[model samples]
Target: MKEAIMIDLDGFYLEPVLVSIGAYGITPIYEKPEPPESEEADEAPELPEPILIGYRVAVPVPSGLFKPRYDLTTWKAALSAYDDAMDAYCAALAAYDPDSEDEPSQPPLQVDLRAFWIEGLTRQEIDNIRNAPSPKTDQQEIARLEQQSTISMLAITELFEMMLPIIMPEE
Candidate 1:
């Protein structure tokens, strides 16, 4: 009777029916006795300990999440700047008179709050923020600013989530 033994090559596992065949640069280990089957058929089967072959190099998995370029302190400063910009913007808008016949000496600067907190913004995100149309009315502008604030908060949250693995890794 032939017995199968599991082999681990890098991170992949391979099981072979015959153990007589030998390959260069490979090591085969005999598996331990199988555990007794449980009464529950739905339970997962126990896998045998894999025989390791060749040197195993650690490969980092891609998170696919945005990595913040700035540290926490810089991000905090950016958030503060964003808040100040929003306040100044809202105040200016509140005092604006749409029906006024005389034009104001100086118009408020249309600053994008995202500019202040662009720690994790991609090129596309930055372009979208920069290319967004200016709101025709003060009310619309305020709404737009509020929406941007929400996006900023979500970005911050994503940044925190991305950092979690580094902060506390699994055992």
Candidate 2:
């Protein structure tokens, strides 16, 4: 398996904003082997203790080589992974939709076809607003809010899926 993957970010970089992809390292934690079972004279054989293997797995990024590594199981590591992925995903979204009200604090980038998906959803929402009648009842309002939340959650899932390759360094 390859250790590091390089990526080009020449067009994606914006002034005062450094978004570079490089080699990410993944720390390996081996699973414990199950104990062996034996039956002889109604006695079980003793199993040897499991061994833990620790090694660094290098990951390829879009830009160049980066040295940051993380353990996936810990809370801190999980949060860091989330933050990094979200940062890149948000940047990509903002670069794609400069006029979006939910833009991140970053400069825009050149036209990227992948960034326009959220914009499509926005357009759909606009069309829905223009065509659908306003909800008059409280139950309808609650249902609308629930639907909005579900849509937002799905958007988040989409973003996460888009960044999964870069976020997850696991084999």
Window of ten residues with lowest summed lDDT in model 2: 6-15
TM-score of the candidate numbered 1?
0.21
Q: What is the C-alpha RMSD of each candidate to the true structure, in Å?
A: 37.0, 30.4
lDDT string for model 2 (1-171, tens) is 234322112111111212234533433335577777775758877777655454333432233212222222342345566677777877686577556677455533432222211121245666776799775799888999999999999999999999998989679
- Candidate 1: stretches off by over 4 Å: 1-70, 101-171
For candidate 1, the per-residue lDDT at 38 reads 75
User: At residue 100, what lDDT does model 1 achieve?
Assistant: 87
lDDT of 1 at 161: 99
Candidate 1 lDDT score at position 125: 85
Relative to the unseen true structure, what is the C-alpha lDDT of residue 52 in candidate 2, on a scale of 0 to 100?
A: 43
